[model samples]
Target: MNSPRLAPPTTWFRMGLHRYLGWEQAVTLAANRLSGFRPVRAVFATASRLGDGIGWYAILLGLAWHDGLVAFQPVGWMLGTALVGLLLYGAIKKLTARPRPCAVCDGIRLSVHPLDKYSFPSGHTLHAVNFSLQLTAYAPELAWLVVPFALLVAASRMVLGLHYLSDVLAGALLGGLLAMLALLAQ
Candidate 1:
């Protein structure tokens, strides 16, 4: 028998991915393919920064402050999910220790920089999805605006070559689920 396995499914699934995916080849392909697009890079860079922690949080807090109790309650849920997403995705990144695409591929046009090293789950996307989805839960009217930003932020991770497509996808799923969990906890 194979002696043992830890994180068996994760390992096998990653291993089984054809050579062009979730690894160096894909990063190279994506970077080389995306590197020439200055316009896309610029847009994604702005979206990344605007959707990131300080940017989005400022908007939420500003809404809370301006709108009085009406906005405060939903902002509360948004903040709660942000906290839960922070802890949850932080742990997953630590555990996965996946390298940022920048570490391996150079063909991508660099735009906004990342704050951390690992790349299994895009932290920006995590917060983006978490905050926006939770906004829908407690602040429905704002969802139309926030949801589109969330999608752009997710795409930005890949466009910047800060993450693989899978990383963005995983972050989206994690964030959505965790946001729901946070709401249920309340």
Candidate 2:
């Protein structure tokens, strides 16, 4: 017969997989390299911790406390966005089941111990962007600090090799959208 034989589904899948993984690995390795210096490692590690931990909340709480209960409306807005955004992040992570960059990229910084296994969408960056959005809407003056801090948090995820650029950027965009929705609700 003159008909051509098509490759099996598994073979096609493997080829596609390798192409994406190879690209992801190369990008991850390059970003991980930025963490070679001790100061960068220290900054990124701390940024990751602060991003993922209660540090963000501490800042929110402090702001709310300083401004009184009525001024705490911004905190409510941020928390609501965080809740929705994080839920979306969790769903994407579960569906993708992507591994952390550190797991794929050897010679990683091994900064702070990650709380979860998969790293499709970064919760830290999600929170950072959501909070920053609310801050921008409520307090433009703080946006100068908040915006940079959010960007740093997003970058920290890559520097620590915990996430890819796609993960953080997706988180940031989704987070901003969620915050906007929360604002409408408010």
Candidate 3:
């Protein structure tokens, strides 16, 4: 009997991509130069929070008044993504004991406080992908916006030296799978 293949070429490719992304020279350049646009980064960060807030409001409205249309589209997407994101985050953290890039790689440094836990799957990347997937489901017309932003968030994690490329890929896959499963459940 043949043993199951674990960590295939795609996995290796992703790992290599992660290394390239986590290279200190590029990260330092982005952190020192591109990050100077504080306003833009702040806006992007706040968008994620706002998305969560919208999800909460929708849930409250749905339970209190039994109305699913309050903020309708955006809220629905937000709620769906949040549910999957939270569940997958727990699973990834428990299953993968990989450390954050900054923790394991001497070649990379973080621009912010280092996370002290497994990094095989990035929570931020998961959340971003979930949001993008949900948005795509809700509004097919916005495919162009949703796809690129999702990719950008995943890339940014590695560029920021917070997560490896493999971590982001795992996160993206898990997040997307969770969203699909949720839809099937309903």
Candidate 4:
């Protein structure tokens, strides 16, 4: 008997990726539904805005103030890593050209304006996680603050309809990897 024909490798990969994207879009829509509530929307919008870099910058300045000149090393690392992250994420976003959930899905509500046109990996979340990991490593005491802020920033991306779950996950993973590399270099 002849065996059934198998789909090509590229077809199989595309099918899997499409299915994953469908699931991610569903999750993004579900989270975005919560944006209808004014308070919830406000909170996430604020978080998304802060994750734009102001929060991280303030934290860096605080560290410098607290540690004086000693904060130079960690602050330098954070700045460098963040610059790399900015470049990496911008390049990947352009390469992926993934549309924001709000732009693609009918049910997804945009709670905040996106920083860039594409949304493959969340820049807000990338910076949040990067700064949180580096700060917590340098001063464990700041974990209580930075970790929750990072989590908020990540969640806000989806809830605000600026990114899909996959985008946020990719950003977190990339951020974590960058942090690890920075730590190793130190």
Candidate 5:
């Protein structure tokens, strides 16, 4: 008796990848609807813009200004980790080349312009989580402020129609891992 031939990679992808991408797109579209409300759009738009780097920089500057030399070590650690995260994020984005939800999906409206052309793992979420975790490690007291802001930054990626759920999840997981590794090294 002859054994059955296995399906090719293309066939397997056609059967599974399309379905998964469809589900992701559906969820992304649903989340994008939240941007319809002016208040919601405004809030997330601001969060997304800040997540671009200004917010993190301001936090570091404020800490330094407030605490002077005491803030130097933590600030240095955060900045170093952020630089690593940016390089890794850029490499992955170039490899994946996944288009932003707003670019590919109908009914997904962008609340704010994207900083980059493609989206896979969200850079904003990655930096937010990484920075938040680093802050928590250095100054547990600041968790109350940084944690919520990190969460808002992650949510803003989807609500702003810049990323899918998987992208945000991946970013969070990667960021957390990177933070853990960096903390351990310290």
Candidate 6:
């Protein structure tokens, strides 16, 4: 009889190895509970609720609907970067049907209202990374704030046990690549 070939380790296993080291429960709890903080909750809530509609509106208003030298130029760049990154993220999500961590893991409880879809690469992390990268490219001085904020967004997904580390890593890479392409195209 031929031996069976084991499947490669899932992205969850590689990125979520920390869970086996005793911090899984603690980190999940922190990620889930931190949302209770008003400011933190507000930030996440706003991002989550806006979806892609806001991005669309910004792009339209800034690029197609506006006509100004100083103001429209920056808006055009910002909207262009955000739109390209978001479109790429959506495409990847559609292509990879990986299940969300919560769907596969019984070890942790997820947020009550978590997104309903695959979790190979987190959309939230991608958005944050892309936005930060674009901002950094435009105004290098804001690196201190943008970098930390991007890190926080990635950490929040991990803490919430909503994504594997690999998901965030892939998302960061995707965002950076898309942002670079967008900038280059401009």
Question: Which has the greatest TM-score?
Answer: 4
Off by over 4 Å in 6: 1-71
Colliding pairs, model 6: none
| TM per candidate | 0.80, 0.84, 0.59, 0.95, 0.90, 0.63
Task: Write model 4 residue lDDT over 1-186, tens digit each, in one string.
Answer: 999999999999999999997888888889999999999999988888888888889989989999999999999999999999999999999999988878889988887778889988988888888899999999999999999999999999998888888889899999999999999999
Give the local distance difference test score of model 4: 0.91
Clashing residue pairs for model 5: none
User: Higher TM-score: candidate 3 or 6?
Assistant: 6
Clashing pairs in 3: 18-165
**Stretches > 4 Å off in candidate 2:** 1-21
List ranges where model 3 is wrong by over 4 Å: 1-81, 114-116
- For model 1, residues 1-186, the per-residue Cα lDDT tens digits are 696757778777877775547465565456546646788777778888887776688778867877888886667777877887788889999999988777866565556677788998887888888888777776688777888888888888887778887888889898888788877877
Give the candidate order by descending TM-score.
4, 5, 2, 1, 6, 3
lDDT of 3 by residue, 1-186 (tens): 998878989999999877786574355345434334666455444443433345334433543355346546455556766776777676768877777766766666455453446777777667666666655665566568667666656665665556666677778887777667655654
Candidate 4 clash figure, as a count: 0
lDDT to native, each model: 0.78, 0.81, 0.61, 0.91, 0.90, 0.65
Identify the superior model by TM-score, candidate 1 or candidate 5.
5
Clashes of 6: 0
Ranked by TM-score, the better of candidates 3 and 5 is: 5
Please rank every candidate by lDDT, starting with the best.
Answer: 4, 5, 2, 1, 6, 3
TM-score (C-alpha, index-matched) for candidate 6: 0.63
Candidate 5 lDDT over 116-149, as tens digits, reads 8989889899999999998888778889989989
Q: Which ten residues in a row have the lowest lDDT in candidate 2?
A: 104-113
